[model samples]
Target: MTRSAGLSEAAVTSLLAGDSVALEGEHELTHRFTTELLTTHRISDTTYNHALQALGRDEVIDPVHVIAMYAAQAAMLNAFDIPAPETNLPA
Candidate 1:
């Protein structure tokens, strides 16, 4: 699905491998914010402020929505015992 959304195969592989630095463009701040949020389940004031300043209020909301939507989808899949699609990438 992400591939169909226009991300390259390599980008998808990197993301699945947790190598966010390999993702396209200068998204270091975004990666940091995501990492912190996922691991801690809460954003620090400093990180939030930095994101607000660099990404603005509207841009900051996007990651939260993406995370929430994906999490919900994963939960539904797990609840229904639905298997994820097979990938051509290496094991």
Candidate 2:
């Protein structure tokens, strides 16, 4: 997706490898947000401020919404013990 969106190969590789130090601007903020959100289920005040500074209020809200929606979906699947559908993509 990053490549398709015109991000450089190096940037995409660095991101996939979880190397936030190699990323800049919005990418760096997003990486930090996702890491903290998935691990702690909360964003630090510092991270929130940085995101606000870098992305403004509207943009900052987007990731939070996405995370919440994904978490809800995962919870529902887990609650029902839903089997994941087969995919052609490699594991």
lDDT, each prediction? 0.81, 0.82
lDDT of 1 at 10: 75
lDDT of 1 by residue, 58-87 (tens): 889988999878878988999999999997
What is residue 22's positional error in candidate 2, in angstroms? 4.8
Q: Mind giving the per-residue lDDT tens digits that candidate 2 earns over 30-78?
A: 8788889988988999999999988899998988898899889989999
Q: Number of clashes in model 1?
A: 0
Query: After superposing candidate 1, which stretches have Cα over 4 Å from the reference?
Result: 1-16, 21-26
Model 2, position 69: C-alpha lDDT score: 93
The local distance difference test score of model 2 is 0.82
Model 1: weakest 10-residue lDDT segment is 20-29
The TM-scores, one per candidate, come to: 0.69, 0.72
